[model samples]
Target: MRALVTGAGRGIGRAVAEHLSGRGYRVALTARNEDELHKAAAACAGETLVVPADITSAVDQVFDRVEAAWGGVDVLVANAGAGSSAPVHRITDEDWSRMLELNLTAPFRCVRRAVPGMVAAGHGRIVVIASVAAKRGDPYVAAYTASKHGVLGLVRSAAAELAGAGVTVNAVCPGYVDTPMTDTTVAEVAAKTGRDPARVRATLAAKQPVGRLVSPAEVADAVWFCVGNGAVTGQGVDVSGGAVQS
Candidate 1:
């Protein structure tokens, strides 16, 4: 099998890429960070192609490279995204546009590129790494939440359109994950609020019923399930540790 994972340089993307590689798939890894992409490729258990480019403009290059080497992509995990905390009133146009571009538009473009081949081949899986914010809104980070909501919208619409085409589109929604992104958030919260970073981290973790932050591997497992399960499509499978139930 052949799989392509975006934002594979680190966090949940890296975990999913590594997991899929372990399952015997030749993986194409993409991210903006060249060093990080190579590091992720090196950790993969199977064959890997490191394509370092901005995902927003690099989808065609990704497809070209993957097709050139492996025929076509059998699976695509559109895991590339970014988030920020800004009140709705304070969010600038640039912030809103960037979030939408990274979290919603880029994934849709990837799906558009991959669907034709999948439709012809009669088999394909696409997973978008969304967030619990997609389901439940929170204070601040309005742009992130809106972008994630748009992701689910895309997933559902695409799934409906491709119902009989042997291509499945789904999403994995994770909550307060223990990744570098969360670490940065923790640090920022601590620095601004005059609290210990460790305490801030704990507070974030405590929001989950599991009493801890979710792991990248857990989200990766959800992605694996989405790709491997043919019966599931247009579903937002939550890996939010009971933080989201709907």
Candidate 2:
């Protein structure tokens, strides 16, 4: 199978690209940073077409390149997201709009562009990278939480509409992970609480019954399940290390 993953320069996105590549799928890696995108491609075991474009930007060139390389994508993993720890009142309009564009709108656009050929071929998978905060009411991340919830809803709606076309749509909701984003969040928490960074991490971990941060590989595993696990659709699998259990 061939796959296209956004925000694939690092962290969970990079991990998914690598994992899918190792699984013998031809992968397309996309992000804004060309250097990091190439670095991610270098780690892949299978073929990767590097397309560096910011999904939030809605760049025409990005979609053009995808159509050129693969004509149609078998799997489209909309994993790009952006956020900050600002409280609702403290957040500017710019902040909220940017978050929505990156986290919610971009994925919708991706799904729209990718599904036509999927319908033609009679098989496809679309995985949205949501967050545990999508279910839990997170106080300081109002925009992010709202956007992720939107992603989950979109997944369900699309899955329903695409079921007859033999396409599965799902979202993976991951909690704290040892990624650059989590690093920034942990550091910010430490600075705010006047606690050590390790203590901040532990506090986040303690929120999960698993008592540890979720790994990128774990989240990737969940995405793969939706992609290949038989007869599954419209599911939002939680990869949050027992946080936000449903």
Candidate 3:
């Protein structure tokens, strides 16, 4: 299989790329950081192509490069996303736009770009890394929550549209992952609330019923399940540690 993982330089994206590569898929790792992409490619157990580009604006170019090299992508993990925390009334226009651009629009563009090739080839898997916020609201992250919710909607609709084409579209929604991104969130919350960063992180982890933060590898496992299962389309598989059970 030929797989492309966006934001593959770090966090959940890197884990997903490594997991797929270990399973014998020729993977393409993409992110805005060229150096990080090279490092991620080096860690892959199988064949890898490193393509560094901002997913929001370079969706077409990324797919073009991948298709040119590997015929077409058989799996697309749209795992590139960002989150911002702000009171609903205090959220700036720029923050909201950034959240939507990264969390929702970029994944949509990737899905749109990869679909035709998948349809032509008659089989594909697309998994978007969303959040537990997509399932339920949380305070102080209005923009992030909204963007995740929107992406989940996109997943459901796309899965319905592509079900007959041998393409599966789904989402893996996780909560409080133990990633650099979560570290940033912890710092931001500590700065805002005058609390210790460790305390803030512990509080976030406690929100999950598992009493800990989710692992990047755990989220990758969910993505793999979505990719390997044909009957699981249109679902948001929660890797949130029972935080947002449906």
Question: 73-132 in candidate 2: lDDT tens per residue?
Answer: 898899988767887889899988988899999999998888888999999999999998
TM-score of 1: 0.98
Displacement of the residue 238 alpha carbon in candidate 3, Å: 0.4
The model with the greater TM-score, 1 or 3, is 3
* Pairs of residues clashing in candidate 1: none
Q: Order candidates by lDDT, high to low.
A: 3, 1, 2
> What is model 1's C-alpha RMSD?
0.8
Candidate RMSDs in order: 0.8, 1.3, 0.7
Model 1 ranges with Cα > 4 A deviation: none
lDDT of 3 by residue, 1-246 (tens): 899999999999999999999999999999999999999999999999999899999999999899899989999999999889888999999999999999999999999999998999999999999999999998988999999999999999999999999999999999999998999999998998899998999999999999999999999999999999999999999998888878
Q: What are the TM-scores, per candidate, against the unseen true structure?
A: 0.98, 0.96, 0.99
Give the best candidate by TM-score.
3
What clash count does candidate 3 reach?
0
lDDT of each: 0.94, 0.88, 0.95
